[model samples]
Target: MSVRSSAGRVRCPVCARPQAQCLCSLIPRLWPPTQLLVIQHPDEASHALNTARLLVPGLVNAHLLITESLQEHPAWMRRLQDPRWRNELLFPGEQAQVLLPAAVDLRPRRLVLLDGTWRKARKLVYLNPVLQSMAQVCLPAGLVSRYRLRKVPQAGALSTIEAGAEALSVLHPGFDKHALLAPFEALIEGQIRAMGLARYQQNYGAASDPAVE
Candidate 1:
């Protein structure tokens, strides 16, 4: 499968999206108090529609680490053991509790988000014992995911960018969650324009109207 355009379309080095669809200019300069860490599966690093890239430029506190296994990475291990930050995995499962502002302690937190398709995310969790041991939390109930470019695995499942924004909103109460998604929505619209309305609608089953935004 082609991860990017092979037909010589110049690409943006920052966002890695095609130059025509690049949202680099839309990335806002905002740093939230809580640290954001994204552990992305290797396969997703080069995917055309990966949302993890969007997080890097949008949030100054965000960092993306790509790996299939975190069993022996020095830096990863160091961060996991860091005493200054409490790490919690942003995942939903039987053990995951609903993430609320009051549930978080006053101490600084490093939110670890797994970035990949549902199957890949589950594989990453299973492969990394450290991740499995971290405290797990889920986003608030009824928060609909607007990541229309791809099919969600289940109801309430959010894209990496959306999840990060929601977590930041909870962690930093005054932050605007909707602003974080502006670039994401723009990216989706750009893709729809690139693909043409008919094809876009056929693929995603949604009307392609730039004005709808």
Candidate 2:
């Protein structure tokens, strides 16, 4: 069911965003070579700026499962166990390998991403032991997340979609990162409009603004 805005406008059923800022048209179904599986925390589903929900649908090979623990889903566990594709965890750590072609040798890889705040994402890893067993990969240092609506708690932090896009860009230069981020940028712009330029500038403008002394 689609939600209604305070102004009584029917929101887009697919994206759940307001009619004015609906991402239905901007979203693309690019079944990239690398498979993407996003495990989301239930808490994020209610967030208006949730990017995982928007990202999964755009990719034909991507799947989004909302759960704190992967052990609860036997079928998904079996899929992860499948030897057809090497499953790797996308997270940062001291032992994490940098995501690169020479490093990540698997031809057809399955990248598992966890979507949540720093604290909650850590808890997800703790709850799922299989995630711990998999080879962990991290994007190169010095990359920044485009998610300006929320404060970044750590260096090189990226939203679920941004992480996926970055990984894809590294794996396949042909992958259209811009196509993937179109809806994401639109969503942010729409929110800024809703808040008005003055209010957005007062709260987050400085952080998002690139010009500085």
Candidate 3:
């Protein structure tokens, strides 16, 4: 087995590929007109299977803040106070009732996505009191997470891309969830194959050889 990745290929620890040719694109991009902010755990950012970076570049208005703790960050606090955007955190709490964007009229359009492990996410919410007060929206999907690399504590907690697109779709019911997700998944799948991950190839790609059928 090839333990080391070649040039132009990345070593995805989950799928196990090198950086130059990473298949992270298989995760979808949420392209809503609303302002988007993703605060990811800094440790999570270095993980090979992470998909947060893929989201930031695709959006017209998006910001990705990778930090271990955001509670004392002046910049993070300042951004939260930006009156131009009506901010909401993408976290579901027992105390937080389910919010449908259509039911309420929020003037400025914005959403904050927390991307990380369940433990890290919980820490993020607990440490940031400001985020706790933000309107919370829980995803209503019965679908399992498409992220096969990491084990989630709950089946419902989806990948970063999935969560982002789902949140946007709820905000705008007519949004295309599939379009946002397909390209990114394709990219991830492609990169995984390039790194010699056979499982992703069989599960997500066209075929090793179309004629084999």
lDDT of each: 0.82, 0.83, 0.68
**In model 2, which runs have C-alpha deviations exceeding 4 angstroms?**
1-10, 102-107, 205-213
Model 1 TM-score?
A: 0.89
> Whose lDDT is greatest here?
2
- Alpha carbon lDDT at 65, candidate 2: 93
Better of 1 and 2 by lDDT: 2
Tens digits of per-residue lDDT, candidate 2, 1-213, equal 778755787887677787677797888889788889999988877677889878888899999899997878999898787777689899896679988764546557899999988888888889998888888999988998878677789888898889988898987878998899889988877777677666777887554454221
TM-scores for every predicted model: 0.89, 0.89, 0.73
lDDT of 2: 0.83
What TM-score does candidate 3 get on C-alpha atoms?
Answer: 0.73
lDDT of 3 by residue, 54-149 (tens): 666656577888776676588878778677667777787876555477546556777888888888888888888778778777777585766654
Q: Between 1 and 3, whose lDDT is larger?
A: 1
Candidate 1 residue lDDT tens string, 42-69: 9898788788888877888888889988
> Stretches of candidate 1 above 4 Å error?
1-8, 102-104, 207-213
Alpha-carbon deviation at 173 in model 3, angstroms: 2.7
Question: Which pairs, if any, clash in model 2?
Answer: none
